[model samples]
Target: MHAITIPEPGGPEALVWAEVPDPVPGEGEVLVEVAATAVNRADLLQRQGFYDPPPGSSPYPGLECSGRIAALGPGVSGWAVGDEVCALLADGGYAEKVAVPAGQLLPIPEGVDLVAAASLPEVTCTVWSNVFMIAHLRPGETLLVHGGASGIGTMAIQLAKAIGAKVAVTAGSAEKLARCAELGADVLINYREQDFVDEVRKATGGAGADVILDIIGAKYLNQNVKALATSGRLAIIGLQGGVKGELNLNALLRKRAAITATTLRARPAAEKAAIVAAVREHVWPLFEAGRVRPVIDRMLPLSEAAEGHRVLESSGHIGKVLLTR
Candidate 1:
């Protein structure tokens, strides 16, 4: 098997596509012949040696993939050889073949092709878990998604709007915000020039957002608290702006808001399986009905994984950048 391996962490140039031994499925796992994988912010951090794979997981960088089941391991059931599926992985999706725990596998949603399906797992799971399952974003509420043009942000906008919530997004450019608006975001704020706190408050008539899906962590903490509505929920999923920040506890207390920070990659298999199940039950029908779809910016061959990383690092893409096998 050939994969984008990192001999030493540095930049996009550090992703080396080279031959590696193929992985064999373990107990309750299945071997997936990779079709495609998507670039993510976490991949950039992993390439720079900042985020290592969870102990004993694959050393490669991809966190999700679409592929077919080539073989099933001991104790695996219900799925069979030649099953077309996508999976949420702890790592190793960058390779041609990856051993995936059966519990994390999902059938490609109807009407979505194999390669494009690669973009669905991680973003869908993350949005569903945080926005719906954890935050309990209700109908008629407002959801403010930071990094609205990115994969998670794009998915958050669609899902929130599908359930009758007004969506607000902060992107770095007007074009990015325009794309967010096409995806059903009601309030689009260019984070580069606009004060998102004031913009969101104004959009919601001074009530602020009922839920905020933030990727920029500490840099927006105090501001996020100030932007929340009464009894709002703030789900922090990334720390792109640095890890440390001051929180206004008095303001948060006044709003009676709640905060939760999570990463999908570090979760146990059972927990990931639960999220996957919830996505299949709730989100898949949205795709099947043509209400939502994967927003891919472009595709590059798996051997050109470095280029994919460069695209993401540049923040030049409107949505997911895929590396196809």
Candidate 2:
């Protein structure tokens, strides 16, 4: 097998595609003949030596992939050899073949092709777990998503809109905000020029957003809190900004708002499996119904994974950038 390996993490140039030993399926896992994988921000962090794969997982760059099952490991059932599936991986989606936990595998949704399905797992699971399950975003509520043009942000926009919620997104440009509007976003704020706290409050008639799906972390923390409606939920999934920030407990207590911080890659296998199951149950049917789809910026060969990283690092893409085998 060949995968994008990092001999010494530095830049996108560090991703080296080279022959490596093929992974074997372990207990409750399956061997997937990789069809495609999607580049994510976490992959960038990993390549820069800032993030490492969880202990005992694959030392590769990708976080999610779509592939066909080659073999099933012991204790795995209900999935068979030759099954077309996409999986949520802690690591190793960059390879020609990867061993995945059976529990994290999902059937390719109807009407979605193999390569595009590679974009679904990570974004879908992250959005579903945070916005829906944890924050309890409901119909008629306003949900604000930071980084609206991103893979996670794009998916979050569609899912929130599908459930009859009003969607607000912050993007760096007008074009990106336009893309978000087409995906059913009701309020689009260009973060480069606009004050999001004011825009969101104005859009919601000064009620503020009911939920905020935040990726910028500390840089936007106080603003996010100030932009929230009473009893709002702010789900923090990424820390593109710095990690530490002071929270005003008095303001939070006044609004009775809640904040949660999470990272999907470091979770236990069982927790990932549970999120995958929830996605299959709640989100997959939306794909089948044509209400949602993967937003892909472009596709590149697996051997050219470095280019894919470049695209992500530039933040020049509207959605997922895929790497194919």
lDDT for each of the candidates?
Answer: 0.95, 0.94
Cα TM-score per model? 0.99, 0.99
lDDT of 2 by residue, 239-311 (tens): 9888999999898999999999999999999999999999999999999999999999999999998898888
Off by over 4 Å in 2: none
Query: What number of backbone clashes does candidate 1 have, counting pairs of residues 3 or more apart or in separate chains?
Result: 0
Residues 187-247, candidate 1: write the lDDT tens digits.
Answer: 9898889999999999999999999999999999999999999999999999989899988
Clashing pairs in 1: none
Cα deviation at 116, candidate 1, in Å, is: 0.2
Q: What are the C-alpha RMSDs, in order, of all predicted structures?
A: 0.7, 0.7
Error of 1 at 259 (Å): 1.1
